[model samples]
Target: MSAGRAQAFWLRNLTAKIAAIPMILTSLVIFIGCSIWTVVYSFTSSRSLPVTDFVGFRQYERLFGAHRWSLAVENIAIYGVLTLVFALTVGFILAALLDQKIRFESIFRTIFLYPYAMSFIVTGVVWQWMFNPGLGIQHFVRQLGFENFTFDLISNRNTVIYAIAIAGIWQITGFAMVLMLAGLRAVDDQIWKASRVDGIPAWKTYVMIIIPMMRGVFVTSLVIIAAGIVKLYDLVVAMTNGGPGFASDVPAMYVYNWLFERANLGHAMAASTMMLLTVLIIMVPWFYMEYGRKNKN
Candidate 1:
């Protein structure tokens, strides 16, 4: 607390502040600069690498004309809905079972959740093989004298999107279960007593009373799931490669292909821009309702 010591402390902080400027600058240079660059490139008729000349809205015209683009948008909706429903249901059931004081809680939890920790590349590959017809679950089961064993959804045009959803659910449900179980565990023990005293059966109590009490947890889970829906890419790439005539193509894959593969920077940017807008349209209101309006009320 001497004057000399206080002066030294302020000097050290000042020097540290000066040192932090370069770090901040480096981050902004990468993040903000690249984002602006993407937006700029989106307005031009650049291919491969970005060019200076601009073509306003022409790229948007070509992008909308592409069947792949349209299919991708549709595929995202289907994948999002199927994954959300199945994952939430399976996760809830598993969580409830695990929460019932099972004999091997840790083991069961780990088994379910361990898949979520694996890289999507690995999950996509494993699932791709498992759903493949000749060398996977189908092969083994078909040999068991069930001659018409069919699990080739990965290659089927009508069902390829569901294959991606299956893989997604396998990887994501465990995490969702962990969330639901945590929410369920946090419910007041008094609620269980109240339900019992009111002559409510356990199943009815959970469905009618307890699950409703965990609305916040459910909303949070759904939001997380929704984000995954919007940015879906890697698994579809590894598993289906958007094959079987663009059956499982998604916005992320479309943007990536335009940006890198075909070098259609303008269209790529347009796709990316549209994606950003779509996410905003979907999420802004939910966020407003959940956080903004709640505060106002």
Candidate 2:
């Protein structure tokens, strides 16, 4: 082709790239604008409207007014800690068992991991039925002459959160097992042989040696689990809908109500932002300590 034609083609391509720049910039601007708008809205006295004037920190003060915020916070703490502990424990155990040349390792791994693939909405519905006193284990057991059998935690106000935790652990631990198993498989086989030759009990080897070596995996799993907890929503909505009163109310639900039902967009932003901040607070230090400090050396 002639140089003039080639030059014209190059000029057209450059022009197109320049024209596309504004679209990218516009998208970024919109995101930033919304985020700033949300924070600004949270401070206004406007309810059910796009409040422009600022009302200082009154929205934040009101957020702490009733028992709802504190109760939701308490529930989050309880649920988060319990789910983390139980899921990690169960996942580790299952992964370890499967790693030991189990007879049906493939089948067992699939069985353990299948629950992770299902959405929490379905899992929640199934668990709700299982926890039902009338149609579930409680009823079946009572019919077997154990009339005292009672697994009605889902119906009870005080114990409902634990019931939710049961489902959380069930769905999450399988995925955790997959992560842990991958980490476990990455371990050098030489370590296992050496431990065996040195007469280290299998359980002790896991506790003392294997676990320490798997710190990276555990931390990775914990970060992922913590993120899930901070953003927890679907299971609660599907299972109990934060029912039997406000017993199982979470920050996510609270934000949703404020945004839609209560029409308090500003307060919704504050509530939702807190969720983000909470995750950041928990993670930032750990990330710095684990990764940043290591890089410094």
Candidate 3:
């Protein structure tokens, strides 16, 4: 395209470009500008307020050294692994079952996807109450004359993170199912017919052909879930509040406590920076795979 053609094209879309300017500026200022500000401040020694005193990587060193921060990292690691495994597995299984052309298929899909429509806070609160020993499943089961049953996962530090993972899975698995179902639906019908005509079992067909074909959907769902794991805050707050002695403290909660509770802007920003780095680490490769490879081709 020549400069004249580009200029003419711009003029042709001038009104659309003018309308997009506000959205573009908002993204620049709110997302890019704020991220830059956060990263810059993370290198400072600001306490309670922003400051110009550059402290190198001292804040980050302190952040990594903190036991609470370490525990938070560990908890998130466990939670992330568990949530990714279970959510995707269970979601795919549910989607596969529904794809069998079962009766009331729409109702089943609705039931599975209903939880995804709920806010994390609501899911957290509901799960929190359900995990309450005195009033929840434990009590109800004991009332059934078991009398010695104990299911206080939320109260135990050793298993609180797992408990959180359970709740997170419950909320997110539905979303994964919907995505998987869409991918399944998008599969060429002739593929299924060919598989059946070849005398291949359904399971073998899905494993060898269908799943491999939904590569984009799987990658997309995995990345989305991983990103959610990195930003896990509100659910923790609503469920356990990182309780059982910070056993379930995730990085987001760690940053929040430092920023608001401890009044340490630099420390908070350092943690936040690490989180942003983790997200970039997850996203950059995906962007390269999705766009860079296509462009190269």
Candidate 4:
């Protein structure tokens, strides 16, 4: 580019750039700086305080060896996978139904999206009550007719993670639906006409053409749900408290417990660093594909 053109590009959004300077500095100093600090401390033998005595991967070794941490990791894996699959499937189905130009569309959208507005804690509490064996679904069902029915999944060790996933899917599916609906609406009317002209089925058009076109929206929903799955502490605390012998424990809860309850800052930092790395592994490539390549072009 010519010198004058380069100068014009730099000065094109001068005021907006000036306004963004504080935010950019804040992100660099707060987010990146604290992340580096945390990773550094993860190598140390700090307990109840931040210490300089670096012990390499000793803290990480202990973190991985702990049974509680293992359970937490396993639970998160199961929960995360189930949440992702169900949220995407259910959300897309709901969005497709809404796209049919049905009556009371806004009312249905509001009803569906209402759960996302509620805090995770509130969702957890409400679901906990509904899942309570004595006073909830089980009792209500038995009173009606069936006395042999037992719906105590929340209190069962084997099924507690599934219960957590139920609450998570309920609260997040609506948000996914909204995103998918927006993506569906963005489809060109001519594309549908072309598909119809070719005698293509609606489902085939969606699967072969429309979904591929909505790739960005799908990625956005995936990232949003994945982030929530990783940081799944609040709902677990409110509903299960990692109970039934740490059956529903997740990584974030493990990190918090090690840091505060166990007073093992190094271990907590190590766990948190692992979570950060996991998020980056999932996000960095998507970021590059979505934005970096566009910039280069």
Backbone clashes for every candidate come to 1, 0, 0, 0
Which is superior by lDDT, 1 or 4? Answer: 4
TM-score on alpha carbons, each prediction: 0.86, 0.87, 0.93, 0.92
Better of 2 and 4 by lDDT: 4
- What C-alpha lDDT do the candidate models reach, one value each? 0.88, 0.88, 0.94, 0.94
The residue ranges of model 2 lying beyond 4 angstroms of the native Cα positions read: 1-33, 289-297
| Deviation of model 3 at 231, angstroms | 1.3
Clashing pairs in 2: none
Residue 257's lDDT within candidate 1 is 88
Stretches of candidate 1 off by over 4 Å are 1-36, 293-297
Tens-digit per-residue lDDT, 202-290, candidate 4? 99999999999998899989998898899999999999999987888999998999899989899999999999999999999888888
Error of 3 at 217 (Å): 0.7
- Candidate 2, residues 161-226, lDDT tens digits: the string is 999999998999998999999999999999999999999999999999999999989988998998
Name the best candidate (by TM-score). Answer: 3
Candidate 3 lDDT tens digits, 70-94:
9999999999999999999999999
